[model samples]
Target: MEKTFLELISENQSILFKICNVYFREKVDKEDYHQELIIQLWKAFPDFKNTAKFSTWMYRVCINAAIDILRKDKKEIKKLVFQKSTYIIYLIMGLSPLEIRKDCLN
Candidate 1:
């Protein structure tokens, strides 16, 4: 299971990179978010049912991890400026901020 998970994650690593790039600015914060994303993905791996594309699932997980970090740092969130591409992703994916926050925190 661990091997398979690692393989899947390796294939989808760009999802983590894109999310970290979108959600964080500073090098340290991006590094921290990358670690947090990997931990969350591992914790949630056992329940992955493969009903959806792994990349899509990974995108959700990455976003949720970012949101979790953002919620913890309200000041950082206020300072956040969503890039055009990030906004496009949100629009295209229909990832509502409220829904993400509720899903992430609970």
Candidate 2:
């Protein structure tokens, strides 16, 4: 069972990288995020019952893990920036909500 799960993951590994790329830009950061997502997928593997397709399950797991990471990183960024001022955060990166989501998702 574990072997089968690893096989499925190998074939659809891009799903993991896509999520990681969106959440992290640097190569080191992306690799770290990829490892974390793989861990998340493995932890959730036992509960999977095939109600959904493997890719679908992988997508959900990857997205949820990435979102969780993004949230944590955002909070950290907020903390660091909070010391400076809200004005810099908003002004320095004037990306729209839609633009930000599109950039990440793509």
Candidate 3:
């Protein structure tokens, strides 16, 4: 299982590079981010249900990991930006705008 996972990851590894490039501007950060992404993939691999394409699943995991890292690294700015975007998503999904704003602010 580990070998197969590693092979699949290697094939789709470009996803990692693209995410790190986008979310990590510094070379050092990119290296760190790449390692974290691989860790996340390994942790989540066993739970993969195989309902989706491997690359698509890889994208979801990597993107989520990248966002998680950014959220931690840029707490204040990321919260504001992410909250506003999440607020819009909630609105589109029929959630009350007031509730969304209150939740985002808090």
Candidate 4:
């Protein structure tokens, strides 16, 4: 199974690189996303029925994985920014951490 996957990926490796290039600007991000695409493809291999071309299946899997990663990162960044802004507001309001927690619950 591994050998077959390797051969197919080797032939279409450029597809993964192309998708990564389209999504990421930094070299490290591209490389990391490339690995993520490969892992996603491997995990989804069992579902491949050979009804469609390997490249087609690979493109779908890689694109979805890339989008998911971006969405997760965006969520984390937004959360961090919100926390920082909340802390600043709390400080200006002279609220303690416990008060901040209670306010958040409310």
> Could you say which candidate leads in TM-score?
4
Which of the two, 2 or 3, has more lDDT? Answer: 3
Q: List candidate 2 segments past 4 Å from native.
A: 83-106
The estimated TM-scores of all candidates read: 0.68, 0.71, 0.69, 0.81
Error of 2 at 8 (Å): 1.2
lDDT by residue for model 4 (1-106), tens:
9999999999999999999999888999999989988999999998988999999999998999999999998999999999999889998999998999899899
- Residues 1-106 of candidate 2 have per-residue lDDT tens digits of 8899889999998888887778789999899989998899999999998888999999998899888988999999988788556445544699666665575577
True lDDT of residue 64, candidate 4: 91
Q: By TM-score, highest first, what's the ranking?
A: 4, 2, 3, 1
RMSD of each: 15.0, 12.1, 11.2, 2.8
Report the Cα lDDT for residue 41, model 2: 90
1-106, model 1: which lDDT tens digit per residue?
9999889999998899899999999999899889999999999888788899988988898898899888888865555644445556765778788765564477
The model with the greater lDDT, 3 or 4, is: 4
Clashing pairs in 3: none
* Model 4 misplaced regions, further than 4 Å: 91-106
Clashing pairs in 4: none
Residue 67 lDDT in model 3? 90
**Total clashing residue pairs per candidate?**
0, 0, 0, 0
Model 3, 1-106: lDDT tens digits are 9999999998998899999998899999999889999999999999888889999999999999999998888887877898788878899888797887777688
Give the total clashing residue pairs for model 1: 0
lDDT of model 3, residue 28: 97
